[model samples]
Target: LSDRLSRRVGMIVPGLAGMAVMAAVLGAAGWLPDGAALVTLVAAWVLLAIPDGLHRSSASALVVEQSPAPSERGRFMGALGACGALASVLAPVTYGFTAQAAGIGCTFLLSAVSLVLALGCVSRVREASSPATPE
Candidate 1:
């Protein structure tokens, strides 16, 4: 089947949006009645898996597809790994502090904000990578 949607526009957008939505829902769940919160949490988690899986499935393919040259792919992958490492170390501590000061709900809101920032960064990368049209 001819794909109508490019990975840049199609997969990433929905995936990021799903993540943001999940975060927001989770945040709001904190204010819900306990039973309702549990149900919301379950539903949010279940819904998030779809786009998250889609995003993850495309992630390695995206890396390879976007790499300008074979030599640069390693560099790109290394940079990706470095980012994951940094986030792994920083997110828990930063989130813990935010939660301690604000509330658990705030931490999820912060996660949503982080996802929005990630989307912005991805947009910038797409702009940088796209081939320019001649005037």
Candidate 2:
């Protein structure tokens, strides 16, 4: 409901929504013919740019949220950072392979599906942790 949560939702949505658009563009531009390596290289670069901005916002959220709870804040932030690191290592390789084998449409579709599922999950988490009275 707030801009903060909206931004997080945007983070996941755009990656799926935008990546689908991008995959279509790459297909139209005939970049797919240029081979998986070249297409993946360029796609990776572009997607990386938008999502990193999203990640930065999430990082800011973590800092802001943790400020009052000085105790355990470091552990909380550290675990969050570590989870991101794990995703970084895994996502590219998985996406690259998916794109290479199934074509860009499937790749985009996969991302979209992932985003939808994540949105649902995050919404639930937010609902659970949120105060009974909305702030």
Q: Give the top-scoring candidate (TM-score).
A: 1
Each model's lDDT comes to: 0.75, 0.55
Question: Any idea how many clashes model 2 has?
Answer: 0
Error in Å for residue 6 of model 2: 7.9
Clashing pairs in 2: none
Give the clashing pairs for model 1. Answer: none
Residue-wise C-alpha lDDT for candidate 2, range 1-135, written one tens digit per residue: 224365345454454445445544444444445577576658755865674466466544534453445575667777778987998999889889987998665665566566556545544433213312212
Decoy 2 TM-score against native: 0.51
Off by over 4 Å in 2: 1-69, 127-135
Residue-level lDDT for 61 in candidate 2? 56
Q: Which window of ten consecutive residues has the lowest lDDT sum in model 1? A: 126-135
Instruction: Write candidate 1's Cα lDDT for 1-135 as tens digits.
Output: 002345556677678778988999999999999999999999998988987776664554566556777667778777777888999999999999999999999999999998888777666545224422222
Q: Report the Cα lDDT for residue 107, model 2.
A: 61
TM-score per prediction, in order, is: 0.83, 0.51
